[model samples]
Target: MTSTSTAPGAAAGPDAPRPAHRETLRTHHGDTVTDPFEWLRDKEDPQVIAHLEAENAYADARTAHLAGLREELVQEFVGHTQETDLSVPVRRGDWWYITRTTAGDDYPAFTRVAESPELPRGAGGVPAIEPGELLPGEQMLLDAQAAAKDAEFFSLGGLAPSPEHDLLAHAVDLAGDERFTIVVTDLTTGTVIDESVTGTGYGLAFSADQQWIFYARVDDAWRQHQIWRHRIGGDPSADELVLEEPDERFTVWFERSRDGKALVLQSSSTTTAEAWILDLADPTAAPRPAGGRRDGVDYTVEWAGDRLLVVHNDGVEGFALAEAPLDAADSSAWTPLLSAGEGERLLGVESFAGCVALELRAGGLAAVRVIPRRADGSLDVEAAWDVDHGGELDVVELDTNPAWDSPALRYQLTSLLTPATVAQVDVASGERTVLRLTPVPGYDPELYREQRLWATAEDGTAVPISLVARKDVPVDGTAPGYLYGYGSYEVSIDPSFVPTRLSLLDRGLVVAIAHVRGGGEMGRDWYEQGKILAKKNSFFDFVAAAAHLVDQGLVAPDRLSAEGRSAGGLLMGAVANLAPERFRAIIAGVPFVDALTTILDPSLPLTVGEWEEWGNPLESEEVYRYMKEYTPYANVRPVEYPAIFASTSLNDTRVFFVEPAKWVARLRETVTSDQAERPILFRCEMVAGHGGRSGRYRKWEQRADELAWLLDQLGATARV
Candidate 1:
């Protein structure tokens, strides 16, 4: 293992070899190699030979172990995997059920079950029924499965009584390709209400009366998305384009006011976001600016009665919730209802029954804040509930996908030392209840605890790290660890629950989340410091965190595994290139390793939009040089790297599947050591994009594959 200092600015010893200067090589296939480590040609060096031998031995052992467990993992996942074929549309009352083909080559089927009034329940209770189960009052529609190789439910929202009037929406690839076609069906009469008369639709919103539907469609060229409004049971000609964003780099998100009198269109360009409001009463009316734009404001709006609740940065560093009367035409009329202060970073907000409920950071801790609306539109501070302690809080955590109703919010919270717990917090009483605390079946939470530590980056910036391990693991500290991070896009990888993660934890493995720069955990300033020219900070921060853990006796170098996805994948790849001996296994999912080449390609979906995140390579030579410096795919060398698993989907539009495909191919061909073991496995979701598949079953299958791979690497076994 390579020994390094945890403290910033620590000088290397005189005996330490001077690092080599590397150059990148560009191939005719449009791929670029940034750091070709030519100095490693003399592999006879003791240091190089030792590193290569250890890596080869580990790889050989892992290969044999994985071969033995592959069949068992597959069989275990298959049995535990539940079939999800029923569709539950948003209904008027308690229950909303629809039919779907469950198993075998049987005909398309139907079923009925009560929908959970509060949280979204899985299809565990819904029983499979034949066609005879359909009542005369109920109706069914099965579109001719032509070119519908993977026809499945997209989204089941808002249902009407009659067959001709019921609204069922889904994004399907009727062309038998990856491009999606938005389809809205009237299940009552079994007819297609709308089938994306325009181009491919991405985001959808329906008016309160359900008469008007607003959606954003993606097209080629300048205007990537156009927001259009269509009336139900109306002619296609009646549909009108409400907002046309001519800049292909911009994306639009629209939401109707609670009363449906106003529509808010948030136009997001590369780095900036601007919102505009339109009067639905007057379709031809021009949209008025909604609020002032902040440099790193990722604002989301919500409506409560006659007022609009804005979760935005009021030209401040962090986020806060503000409010303005819906009747106010001027954006300046918006008033600061809540201020962004220490521990007041607003994470989420929901409006219910004339009250605004919020999830925020208070006192450097995760907490809930509520404000009740008065008759005149002003708000009164209702209550505040602290979810976790400031010291115990994982600063870089985010909520597990939450499900909420009007009066109660249901969500799961997980921290470094804590298993995920499904909790329900009542708005009125400020009472918090834990519904389900994630358990490893036999393992106990009392045995594991999380420790929060801080390390300094090369620039003396304080980086936070969360380390989770079994309590029995001696503080004298000899433990294997898995470090994870995704320090880009200002995204905070907050603590969340994953059952598969238990496979590592139960085996006395320590899992750590490195809250590196380039993420939103510390604030907008932190993100700005780690992106673009300062992007190298992300790599160094991860390395510093790892060193901190080892210095603190939490783990040894050879026992650590590094993992990341997408931009985080880029982080994993770059760190591996910089210090391969620090980790045992590296996992890069849908990795954007070939950053320089992808940025230069205009044909990619989000390439132009990324100029704000990664800077424009086409226009600036400086950016071109900096991007090449950290581009993972461009930095591959002949040195023996840790056992690597780089995965990508062929249908992924955001990062382009070819980046990983090209990267793995190059790694396999160029690398000299079979000991490094570049297992470039490509799991192409033949049916989906960016996000694997639409159905729950399809997603679990993917998860199973990932878990199997992780288990194989960690030398852990899955629960049978």
Candidate 2:
């Protein structure tokens, strides 16, 4: 698809191409709805492909003026980033694993070096390395750039080294379909030994003996429902089926415990979960249940020394910590180690030989606390203390402390202005040392500032907003602002650093994150208050956030823009309908705009499993009506809307391209707004999936395009 050349500030090009409409009747809960654009769901239809391509051409024509700006932004990203860099090495077994990236390569190379007395731990128990420098005797494990050289799209699913560190089992997806193939390599000889497993999910674990590897397999609906054990260098057809989840709502996953003594197999739904323990010593033994699955109770188990550390949300909304003996790890054997706090959410627990790190959230920010361990490895709760982050908005969490016996704890810290930093703390003496700060060649943190603001929702609930901009940017109402949000599935959109965002902030734009409901930022109750029957709260909360910014005289409403992706994209659609006049434009990426319809069809990927998050509309009349009230596609009326840009990928299994394609079509036909002034644009990535692109450069290009369009809409295009 090609577009006609259009100069900056040019008139609308040849009227946005419109797709043909065909009605399909969808009946659920005794209600029949006519979906005019439902035919777009058929990806195989030639007409559908043509219509999408036409939309693509139109979008390209409309945004052609931003070509220069896009290029400049891309350059800014490249300049700010240290093109050739090395990640802080992580120690596991006898090796120090390190990832390296070259100046122009799109992917990173994984390699490891054997531990030795010559290469001692530098400051804070981390290796001292400069940019592009390699540790001595470093051997190549996987060169992602080399592996992705021939594929249009490539994703690394899982990389697991055997306990003996002789075999490396890795999974790769070349089609962006999320189905991966497991390949085993003899690390000692640098040769591939097995390519026998295919159509598997994203996790892999090896038996302690290194003879077998366990992986998950997805069903036709794209749910990971089966766990299989494949012998090293054995035929895929003879792989043993370890377990299969019969319930559609549940998905199976397995991971090696922190201690590396057992493989923890988990079967989880949105609101419930259970785990099985497979002793690594006996890979063929029957799995032992840690706890029985109870409705509405979610828990995760990790082996900690002689006991099991359990983080569960049973009697507590924000979750609590419990401990059980490894021999009798049933629910009845659990005893409280840390009781639930009123305003704090216990996210998870990571155990070390000398201490346990509790990753938790409190006051709308992430923090970590360390509890000293007794001589026998049980947590000494009375001696616990929270880590001192020393920054107002710094987000701190436990990093990869893979070795159970390490005396120090590694944690990462970052905020809106600060780049990512890895630091370690001595558990016994509480001595913190800065290990390595991610190298950003030309970034100056001093030029940026971060602030926290709370906006009251319509129901009197306070939503937190994190704002970041150039230090010189004023708080007056004249500046343009971009608000972002994602409030679904308890996923918290924390304040973190992004180098590319510098392009926006440098241009005098204020970028903010709305920590609204349905997110785990506050706690479990925070998420519960915004999902299912209360899902509309997410939309209202976001609209309220925009209104708060305008009312606070921080940003001009007419110059404000908003963006969200996936579920957040759902937020964008809902708010565009709920309060179109509150902003200048909206960008929805792989948006779940057609929520009710997708959730009603059980055959769709993630549909049946989403019943707990979004109530089942097929079985409940109330759910049908509730979803109908705010679902973007069904609620589109002949009302004015902000300039809308929706992006989707053809192979996106999570939020199918049809959702956005249909939503954009409805908006073009139904909105009463002037198409020339507030044109609705849709871009479909023909060769991509849920995430638009794979390689770093291609991903950055997509970002630059979106940012350039947003800058244009906000009238902040001129580089400051």
Candidate 3:
């Protein structure tokens, strides 16, 4: 593949040509003090007006092309997989059940297994192997006959009660566009008493009585959702919009207090959010603001009789679990039960068997059973369980989306390392039994290892990178390494197991996750350093980490590949443009490469929300000029570019597919690389959104395609 000329001050190859532009781009957004909109506001100068109009026109055309490509890609990828749904929901008799659709089927079958059990013993005093198991050290081949018999799993769904009073379980149904549905099951009769109610959007919270269901639904305009309440067993037509924003710009998130007396919701306007409380009895009552100027708050509500235990942000850093008298109409009645700190956040709360259980994260997962102050006015921790896993429990792998039946204490205890199977902490006996360790199939934990490494960026900031590879791989720096990063939105990329990733490591690949700035790895400060005017830090940190790997002889430039998604896609595109020779191949998946144009457009879902990450171009000329310089699509020049694979989704409302589409198109037009040999493939998923596909098999296929592309670039092959 032909490579681009090195920028001024950039290390150059022996044969590489130097670029004319030697100066690095300035990215200070605050330097331009004057109104950046002055150019648009004053159209008297024909040259300025013409330039603005041309840029606007180009942006509009690109957006339309992207939208069209999204639709086309969705259609193309839809037929590649059979319909299948996967879900775990609590059934009657407190049994946890999993439901899944048969290949090519629309409906799901459910399976029920006791939360506590032991396999039947076998001959000769040796434990017998179950249908799903094989002899020790042997590969467990899935039994076709057993799979057919297990097809009855979905039938368990039919056994749940559709009760008017029972709290419904939320199930994510994949056959229907992967939407979540709420259904109430009768534990006694083993039948569903209520029909499934489709969820509004992503979030869902149930009321105390199980009659009222609170959820957020998307409307026509912006991507924000309005909180709605639906009564189970009541007329579906009677569903009420409990809370909504008249202005389309703001978004609201709502949840019910454990007692169901008050509805707590957060209304966010751009970067700021305000919490509000509404009386459940009086739906027409105006919501009272709970706090002010709080950037964000993590909370959960639990009921202790008539009072509410609210884990709230008290206009301070971190959070505190407090108590409030719900009997009063005033929100001021709330009082803090526990102090807030830099690392304190409430994970879950459970009130069962006349005991109030709370799970908190101070240093590690801490479970404390609280005895509400009797009429005597004294508080005490009835029982406490401090999860001392010695950091062996990988908190990064815990699913952010908690299960419906997730215990207030046990969930917090096992909410790490790929979702613990069962954390059986007996409050009475103080005995704990962890059942069925969650396994990343195909991964031998003994053969793999994880380590934390820090790389110093150009700005002298230490960027933490997580490295995971086969322990068997020689440290002699000969392994093919893949580095990944996403440094936007203060979203921390935690350590999670991906089965496909193991395939790469098994093939002598060293995978590294660069925890760069503009991410919340080290908390808010780390994020702030890499966003807005400091956004260049994100790019620089990634490049620095890649350089560190090369300098350390962990991987050579020609053997290293960088992979990123969404904003990380922007990172991949920028690094590939800024230092194309450093990476062997670039996989930019569902990228936001056309950052400048997308930020300028008001029609995009994340445009307004993104002002915090990428400064408002309309408000500052410095931001506009800086973004224009590094904008992936705009930055593609006539040079020998690295081999690229840009993937896009047709239905992604966030980070629309057009970004990658336009990027690939621009690279094809600008670069002189051979189409066949140094291919820049544009693989668009026609039916999927931000997530490629719904089915496991389909996702595996996409992973295979991606891995195949990377291996092909590295001149490696999947061993048959």
Candidate 4:
């Protein structure tokens, strides 16, 4: 899609539907290049679905003049959301569950409620799910707006229930790809006992004697390689498989062990892992492994009490906490317990039957600690603590404890102007509580104000960012910022709260988040100096956090704006080709902008397991010239960039949608900008995936049509 001079949302005029180039050469190591929009990567090309429906009808006739500022940013994201809410229920043993949400249901119903000795257990044994009656024996599990009323892209994936909760299972999907479809039901004869599993891939468990069910399938490069089992009235062609992961770089699944007595199973990759276990009181046994695979060793197990915690990075690289012995067999008999500290990073390890939470990441946010359990039940890791969460750039975490003999714990906190809460500490007298806070309606965390700034990069390194705004705006230099980013797997983009970002902080804009260098925020050596050949230090720490927010005048060197998604949309296409005049609009979502033609094609779908996070440029030539030096569709040049947009989806499956449809057809044939005042747009989505259109008011009308075109390119559309 690259030649145009008109025919896109054509009212027969203002041009821009360029789709004609068909060059395609792609050699490698000895460098052969020439890829003119690689035939828009043929999605069964009917002229590549008519050039992605004529670039979504030229991005709906160029934002059809921002449809009333995208319906006032979807009614200011439904007037700061809280529409008939519910959540905080949790329990999971004698039932409790909850989920609710009804005001204009785009999905959310899943009820439960049964542990009755007639109510009363509030604060931590958590019973009070009040509002509008029905508690006595409640029930109705799964309405998901009546299973997404005949799906047009629902998603759920794994729900699972049956530990005598009388069966349920769930799964579904409906074509936002990640294949699903399990079903099962029978919660006390509501019937449908097993839709015979179908494809499957987002985890599910149910075996502690409900007779089998496991799941996790994928492959054909959609990875999650095998696992299976089935049987509860089975015959999805007599299921069974149980573990296949023949290393196309790992990726398996499993779950069930917060004392449901063993399931774990894992596998993983992007730098090694392995874990198995199974047992569930022998529901046809056979999972076993707990350790073995090694490479750069990574671990994961859980079950605490009679041991088996794990969490590893084998001889430590910012992860540690061992334990083993539940019929041990690996890491040469584990043991340690916590160790790995210096600049922290831990990340996960839950356990409960009184305590053992963890989850860490230091110097750069996220906390949640706990330890308790030592009257002889074990894990007093030097009596651990930290759960305060009284903001130090708040993030907190460790949520839904699912009753592993509930000594409470729960967690969650938040930041970027609070509104998230969900407390409940007490891992033996820490005594917190809160339980539910998220109601935002007209949010006013004292009219916002968050900070933690920093920046530096180009090898000097520093980074950080975060920001948030509207504490009476005025960050001199005329505000209007926006920022956001993602860096890459070492994930960590924390600070939560989003009632549609209070419609970009009540419109004065600002916002922020960089935390760059392949983010796990300052931890595993800040993700080993930003990955493979120091992946251009995540585009020079996102163009040095946009030149330290426009040289500290705090944004507005032309109203800023930026964003990311999917590997932070490959760090927003390498900072829009490394600083395309410091943005005035960017976006990128589901991007991964043709990273060296999808990592030099190892037959695509997750390109050879993302060669441990983008490196094996098909047998290195210094990883194919270090991924063709910042592969944003081979570094599009002709400058003058900004105002881009890009979005993708048409069933994404991990950054596909032809890499933002050949990077908006090679920036509409190599940028030099001014295509009628900086327009690049391209959108796509048509029946979504890679997180786009999937109910919840179609994801708030696709985030109010991408924040009404990023509040009309950060001039901040209307509302004060």
Candidate number achieving the greatest TM-score relative to the actual structure: 2
TM-score of each: 0.75, 0.98, 0.70, 0.31
lDDT of each: 0.60, 0.87, 0.57, 0.80
Best by lDDT: 2
Residue-wise lDDT of candidate 2 within 143-229, one digit each (tens)? Answer: 999999878898999998888889998899888888899999999899999998999997999998889999999988899999988
Query: Which ranking of candidates, highest lDDT first?
Result: 2, 4, 1, 3
Tens-digit per-residue lDDT, 1-720, candidate 1: 111122211112212112234464654334454544433323346643443344334333434434434444434434432232333232323444564544331233333344444433432222223323443334444422332444642322222232213565555443222344556666555678777444555555555456666666676532346788777667767787877776656777776554446678887764666677877666556777776555655676665656677777657656767778765544477777766666356766766564566776543335555566566646775444444424466332223211223455544566655555556556566666654444434445677677678988778878988777777766555666789999998787776545455556755677888988898777667778888888999999999988888888888665677889889989998998887778767788878888888777676666787888888877877888888888877777887766676665445556655566556545655555443233434344434555555444455555555655554454444332
- Supply candidate 2's per-residue lDDT for 246: 95
The worst-scoring run of ten residues by lDDT in candidate 3 lies at 1-10
Count of residue pairs whose backbone atoms collide, per candidate: 12, 0, 24, 6
lDDT of 2 at 84: 90
Candidate 3: which stretches are off by over 4 Å? 1-199, 204-213, 231-238, 246-249, 256-263, 269-271, 277-315, 318-323, 327-386, 396-408, 412-431, 439-442, 672-675, 718-720
Error of 3 at 159 (Å): 15
Query: After aligning candidate 1 to the native by TM-score, how far in Å is the CA of 252 from where it should be?
Result: 0.4
Candidate number with the higher TM-score (1 or 4): 1
Rate residue 408 of model 3 by lDDT.
Answer: 27
Give lDDT tens digits, candidate 4, residues 1-720: 011122211222246678887798867667888877788878887988898888888888887867776877787788788778888888788778888887888888888878777886676667876654557778888898887787788888878788888888888888888798888888888888777777778888888888788888887768888888888776778777878888787788878887788887888896788887878888676788878887988778786758888878876678888887898868899988777567888878888777788888777888877778777888778889888756768888888787778767788888888878898877778878887888887777887788888889877878988888877877688888888888777888877777788777777788888888777887877877788888789888878888898888887888888888888888888878888888878888888888877777777786888888878877889978887888787787887888787888888888788888888777877888766656787788767799888878889988888877777766677655
Residue-level error in angstroms, candidate 4, position 477: 25
